[model samples]
Target chain A: MNEVSKPIPVADAETAPYWDGCREGRLLIQQCADCRRRRFPPHRLCPHCHSANADWVEATGRGKVYSWIVVNHPVPKEVYREEVPYVVALIELEEGVRMVSNIVGCDPHDVAADMPVSVFFEPADGGMVLPRFRPATGAA
Target chain B: MYGLRDKYAIAGVGETAYTRNSGVPVLDLAVEACLNAARDAGVDVKDVDGIVSYNFGDSAPAIAVATALGIPNVGYAVDFAGGGNAANLITLSAAAAMEAGLAKKVLCFRAMNGRSGFRLGGGREMLARGVTQHTAPFGWITYPQAMAMWARRHIVKYGTSAEEFGSVAVTFRENASLNERAMQRAPITMDDYLASRFIVEPFRMLDICLESDGACAVLMTDAARAKDMAKKPVYIMGGAYGGGPDQGEDLFDAIRWPDHSENYAAYIADDLWKSAGVGPRDVDVAQIYDCFTYSVLMQLEGFGFAKPGEAGAYCASGAIRRDGELPLNTHGGLLSEAYIHGFNHVVEAVRQLRGECGPRQVEGAEIALTTAGAMTCGSAMVLRN
Candidate 1:
């Protein structure tokens, strides 16, 4: 597949730590101090317990494809046309938080629900290392 | 407990020709629909004092419509957020205004050049806050992608196949084929639906709504005054609009929420049915939002038409077809008909109850249920002749 110009994510106060972990090859998520539940897309308050107190924890980075889509349409940037058909997957991590990411290292059509995956960091636009998922078997 | 129930009636309904490209500004479409509705209601354009449009910010503002139509002044104008939610909320807003004696005649409309002008297909920012901050970076930008995830999960859990989803497309196409105003009137078979291209996996091209350039408008007033109007006033039996918990949160993250299938439609079911003093059996026709085919399937179960995991089979059984027990989307809906957001559904619901739909009219249709799509929020209206 041709390299598509991917949109780089700018880290914000709530999500910066997660991006920082991706840069360092650590899959980090927020853990609620009150209920001890983990969450993705870091927020100020815990969605489960509604507690404001939370801390970061490194994840195992292993997950299963809860659901997926093969996007046949063009992506945001014009450069993404070269990669017309790409895999956009929702991965349910072992820690029980589901996050959206691309499934690399496999044919776009070959990916299916419940496929095993692992998080990997790749250099993206803006000198940022983005975390994407790949087949757990290291197919690429 | 719904005080506005049966107090207000739809005085008039008007729609511009549904097309893919109008080549005119959305403002023009707004004026045409609003003026047509005013003319249909037998009310002078200068007499309309209240105006309301959904807060999409893509269409002509209420004041803009009023100014274009030469209205003297505006009273009780509102433009609230949420696209499909505005379908019922705007009408309900008009009803509330009439109840409060704020305005006599109220105009509610939705106008968009969705295909030729401003397209919802692109990944460009639509809503800037909340979900976009997380989903956009991953190319999870459009509604199809988000809704596809929901469909995919539903399929995995219920063994719902693509054929079942295609049935909805076929059913709507059949309905739209009889509707001359619908954008796509060609009948589609299940094979055609299965053969269609996939914009997003689990959601074929046929499953998504057409992005058309058109608009639809409705006029509302007190039920007692509507008795002498140009057309039969479709009384609003009961209506409700609300959302479930964490509606804006990531869908996949909350797979464990009480009942995974309980969307806003499911959550608001009790209020909708109870206030209307009717059940699923009493609904002669239903215009459930068809932004995507799976949504129709979900809403079928959400509104208590079928048990969870049984809607797919219920659809396959041809219950939603024209001659079926519960005729749905008789005007083809957004899937085949023009996507005037969800306002087109409202117009179709009114027309069916009025017996104006000659070929596709549901026999003895006395009550119609019009619903908006499930878009982080939803709204529903139960109307009776």
Candidate 2:
């Protein structure tokens, strides 16, 4: 694995493992051990049952674009100053969790709400393979 | 609603002046707001046992204010949400903290000299903020600019007008003239609103919320003790703070109907109404969030006052006018009163219910509903006599 790029801001202790999966080219979400409920954007405890007992579950990374906006403005310099208008979208994983990720490999206009898409990671200028998303169709 | 209603009321409310780069510190604004709210409530500093605030400007452990003011032992503590969200959060927390045997007398506050204290500019500094970096860099820069995209879609879908939008500004300015705390009390006409320069295409400069240094507070004790207190006991009938975390298909897509407050305001109203077992019918007045006039229009639909696409007409009918069937923004609201986030809305609701407003007050207001929108979180509360 390449060197880790940006440090996780809000993620801590219990959320570490989920971030770890991203480095390994895997999308891991949280699943409550007791309630059989799945959670996204990793947290320390299960929000459904407030149970601390949970496990990291690998996700299929395929879902629909719930809502999105085409960003034409210059990006924040700290993140990236590229002036490219990219589609920033919230992807709802098939496993029933929504995570915000940049939609890559398509024109900004091509993206739409509820459009099927799948997760794909790419190498960044830095060492990390940034987790992004691409349009997809239902298939095996 | 009558007995002890005028006893332990809001005797005083204070705030630091808001400016783009007001050199004054943010903490100073919070202290000012706290002091003003106490004055509005007519309570002494030492009498405040509970400390509650929506976390925006102040740090956690707000006892610092208590310590600074020589009032020791802030028995209650809270820091939740950002933006004007703290309005309901502080109130609900203070009310419950008092009800659940946490603290007897509580102070609920939100203060931020956002523009001056930190200069809420849209660049690198914004990236460090919670979700400011998320949509901001991608062309959705300012809060109103982000909402403007949806506003355009609404105009297209429903055929709303610039004139209609201006009416909201006019009404707010009219009411705010009576609010000594408001930054802009000058009269504005639809001609002026329509003529104002545009900030985000369809949205003009007036469409955006002011960036100011201001604070607001509310004091609470259980209904039992409130009866013996100084002012009218504006009873908390119901309250809720919640929103959707769902990211379904199209989660990333900008809204078609464009309920910008999909997560917070709508649900806050629904849940609060459900919990109180009362609908909008029970409300005599509404202190809806007015970060933008569109927000008020959107909330009117969200809170069940009007149907979607009908807010333009509802507002145009002067329904939300100060003398309409259901008065709104009686204290001028954020649009004119002061952008104390949404905290000022709650304070005004209490004022109207108590019939405390001299000229701007809504006559004989009994039940009032106040709502707010956090980034995506929202909260609302119902107050009754």
Candidate 3:
């Protein structure tokens, strides 16, 4: 994949911590202080309990492939042309929130629904890091 | 309750020739379509007091189109935000304006050089904006990829085979073959669909909608006034728009959307049927949005035409074919017809009701349903002659 031309994510105040966690090789997600529920794409208010109180808690960084697609069409950039046939998946995290990421370290055809996976941070353009997933080790 | 039922009517519908490149400014396409609608309705352009349109920052604004068409003294005008999701709502808003005595004749249009100018196809710069910023870094940056994820989930959950999804493409292609205005009018078989290259896994090239440069317009007025129009009036029976919980989130944000299998149709189906005083079975034809083939399956189930998870089997049964129980996308839909971003679907519905679709016209068609947008917040309308 052409990592040099790949777009890097810009973080706002609400999402800065999550990116910060990625840079430090940790996965962070917002946990509602009142409902004790976890949410991705950090926000101030809890959607479940409508609570403004929340905390950035470390995640297990493990999940199952809920669904995925092998992208053959290079979109948003011609740089992705070489990256065609990459697996972009929705990972249902252990904490009960789902996220968009790539399933690396495996053949695109090998990824399947309910396949257990774990997260790893990868450096990107600029000083940003991205959380991507791969097949879990020693797990069903 | 149901006060708008048959109160306003679509007196005329018009369109520029569906093409890959119009070779004209977006305003010219808009004016041509608006004037054609006025000619079709036999109404003077100056009489159109209200103008409404919707776009994703791609089309000529309603006021600009009004000025170009020389429609004097526009009393009410609105340019709705978003894309196909606002297709039905824009027409409904015009009807609302008519009902409130804000305007006499309203013109609703969608004009864009979707192919030649600002394409809906995502670009590198677009990836840096809004929610896409989060997904772009991972190479998740296009509508087909996002929708394919949902299609994958539906297939896994329901065992909906890829062949069943191809059935929609084949059937719509057959319909398009009869439509001279369709961009993809060649007949395609299920084999053609399956053999097509995958834009995203679970979504082949045939499964995605065409991007064409075109425009469509519809004229709306009170039923009493429509009685004197040139063409048969297709009454606005009823409709619904908006979404359920977490619908405000971006289409790719499946994190907050509780059910990937269900779309906004499920949430608004009850209101749509109740207000129309008709069930799904009562409709003779439908123009379900076909941003992707799987979306047609999801809507078939959500709108009560098929049971949950059975829409695949329903399509495979040839129910959406021209002579089938519920003929769909008689003008070939966005999949085959020019994608005017679902506004053309509304045009097809109006034409079907008026018996103007020539060879592809549904037999004995009186009622038709048209839906816009597949995921996130969307809209649907029920119309009849």
Tell me each candidate's RMSD, in Å, in order. 3.2, 6.4, 2.0
- Judged by TM-score relative to the true structure, which candidate is superior, 1 or 2? 1
| TM-score per model over all chains | 0.93, 0.71, 0.97
Candidate 1 C-alpha lDDT tens digits along B45-79: 78888989884557888888888998986776777
**Candidate 1 TM-score, true structure as reference:** 0.93
* lDDT of every model, 2 decimals: 0.82, 0.66, 0.88
Residue-level lDDT for B28 in candidate 3: 96
Candidate with best TM-score: 3
Question: Which one is best on lDDT?
Answer: 3
User: Against the true two-chain complex, what DockQ does each candidate achieve?
Assistant: 0.40, 0.10, 0.58
lDDT of 3 by residue, B1-385 (tens): 1578999999988899989889999999999999999889999989999999998788888999999988888989999987778899999899889878899999999999989999886654533545666777888777787788879879888999989999999999899999999999999988888899988898999999999999999999999999999998999899898777866356555556778888888988998999888989899999999989999999999999999899999999998999999999988999999899899999999889988889998988999999997887788999999
Please give, for residues B1-385, the per-residue lDDT of candidate 2 as tens digits.
Answer: 1122222323344455655554666556667777776666567868888787765344324676666656676777776646565567677766667657778788777767655554332432332123332233233444554555555545655677777777778888888888776778898988888888765446677876666666666777666666766676787777787655542112122322224433356656667877666798778888888877777776777778888778878887888888898888887777777677788888788878888788887878888988886335567887787
iRMS, all models: 4.8, 7.2, 3.2
Q: Comparing 2 and 3 by DockQ, which wins?
A: 3
By summed lDDT, the worst window of 10 consecutive residues in model 1 chain B runs over B251-260
